[model samples]
Target: MKKKFLVMSDSHGQNDLVQEVIDKESPIDGLIHCGDMEEAFGKDLSFPMYFVKGNCDSRRIGKKIPYERIIDVCGYKILICHGHLYHVKYSLQDLINEGISQQVDIICFGHTHIPLITKKKGILLLNPGSLAFPERGYQNSYIVLTFSENGIHYSLKEVMEY
Candidate 1:
């Protein structure tokens, strides 16, 4: 069996982008939202999504779907969170350290609206950033992770507006 994930974060209110990405991408097994997806958008998302609570997430949204501290994504045990709760950006090292302590194979987060994929102490850290408004000033994109029996590969796909 093969495993593939569609990852996005910080929609801020852009639900159409989510739909656009899903429609355009090939096959994907799951979805991960690093959060700040406004309530209006999150509710109507058509795929299975695991999300963390961003600082901007309202109490209502949090109450409806509490962010999971850890998850088993594909064959990998992952720590998933919005970086604000973990103090990212200024301290990615610290966040990675904590993920190591938690014995997670992958650490996924979003908050800085910048994409990053790096390894530290055997842990893979990934930030898909904002799929709606990328701070990088390029087009909005999402990271797709594909897992096979041999290994894992990732590709970033930008959404095209119709």
Candidate 2:
């Protein structure tokens, strides 16, 4: 069996880009919005979605919204966060430490506006970057993670057609 998920982050205030990605990558098992969404776009999605509150998300959005989430898919544990709390701009050590403590298999976050995928201390760390406001020279993109009996695989997909 193969389970696939679409992962994104740092939309900031642009829900249009979010829609674009969803339209392009439908039929997925689930969608993971790392953080920094503007509105209630999750309601419009066709598939199940996991969302976290980013630094920019105001309390007005909801008192129940959480800053982090843990999801299990195909026996893989995934941690989703916005990265501001972990100081991702400077280093991934904070995030890595959290994953270690939590005993998660994957850590996904955004905030540096840079796309990254790496394995640290046997844990997979992913930053899908910003679909709306990518860093200079970086393409607007997201990630997809596929889990199978064999193992897990990932890919970085550019959202910008150009």
lDDT of each: 0.78, 0.86
The superposed Cα distance between candidate 2 and the true structure at residue 134, in angstroms, equals 0.3
Candidate 2, residues 33-148, lDDT tens digits: the string is 88888566745555678989888886535657789999888888889999999999999999999999999999989988899999999999999988888999898989988888
Cα lDDT over the full model 2: 0.86
Q: Lowest summed-lDDT stretch of 10 residues in model 2?
A: 38-47
Per-residue lDDT of 35-130 in model 1, one digit per residue for the tens?
A: 788664544444467877788886636576555478885668888788886678688877877887889988888888888888888988888877
TM-scores for every predicted model: 0.88, 0.94
Model 2 TM-score is 0.94
Q: Give the C-alpha lDDT of model 1.
A: 0.78
In candidate 1 the C-alpha lDDT for residue 102 amounts to 88
